[model samples]
Target chain A: MPYIKIDVTREGVTREQKQKLIAGVTDLITEVLDKDPKLTHVVIQEIELDDWGYAGEQVSVLREKGITAKKQ
Target chain B: MPYIKIDVTREGVTREQKQKLIAGVTDLITEVLDKDPKLTHVVIQEIELDDWGYAGEQVSVLREKGITAKKQ
Candidate 1:
């Protein structure tokens, strides 16, 4: 069994987008690694700006400080 | 910076239990890996019985089939 998780900053994610991701990730795994779709678990995790940090500072704090770097 | 994710089967978990997990996981990462708590990302993912699988069967199906186990 393979467990997959997607972590993203919770700013403007829609339910439809999440659904697409769940399906896309599952299909990709099935095509690439040949894992069964039923056993291939995909989890979407949304993290708050305040809880996400980079360069020794929270994303919220960085935004406040006029820093606009994106995570890819 | 360290990112730790915990995947658990959703059943009878309490909010208080999740809070403790966040704290304990953060502490463990900080102590063991010397990571900053502020940058330490801990995401707890709860999967449904119907969404989880083991030994070529869904957890919900396994439970229905009288198979119970734990994940650690």
Candidate 2:
């Protein structure tokens, strides 16, 4: 079983977006890793700004100073 | 750096419980894996019943049928 966990900031992600993520990840795993789609589990987690940290500072504090953690 | 993610169903998990989980997991990793606690990141994610699937069915549907996923 291939279990994928995706963590993102709690920035108003919609249900449709979550569905797309699950489907896309499943497809990717099946295509690349050759995992069974039925056994693939994609879990999405949205962390609050205050809970996530970067470079020894909370994300909320970083946002206050105009610093952002980009997905790349 | 060690990043640990714990996923559980959204079933009224309290904030105090989450704090305990973080501390307990950190201590476990430090003792077992010898990882630095400062570099350890423990994230807890609670999934909706409808979002988590098991046995080819959604968790909510399984719950309606008196089936539960246990932590082991």
**DockQ value for model 2:** 0.14
Model 1: lDDT of residue A16: 99
- Please write out the lDDT profile of model 2 over residues A1-72, one tens digit for every residue: 988777888877776676667777778888998887778776677889999988888989999998766665
Best by TM-score: 2
Question: Comparing to the true complex, what docking class would candidate 2 get?
Answer: incorrect
Model 1 is docked with a DockQ of 0.09
Instruction: List candidate 2 stretches off by more than 4 Å.
Output: A70-72, B1-6, B11-45, B49-72
| TM-score per model (chain B) | 0.85, 0.87
Q: Which pairs of residues have clashing backbones in candidate 2?
A: none
- What is the Å distance of residue B27 in model 1 from its true position? 0.7
Model 1 RMSD vs true structure: 8.7
- What's the distance in Å from true for residue B45, model 2? 5.8
Write one digit per residue (lDDT tens) for candidate 1, span B1-72: 788767878777665566667777777777888887877766666789999888888999988887777654
Pairs in steric clash, model 1: none
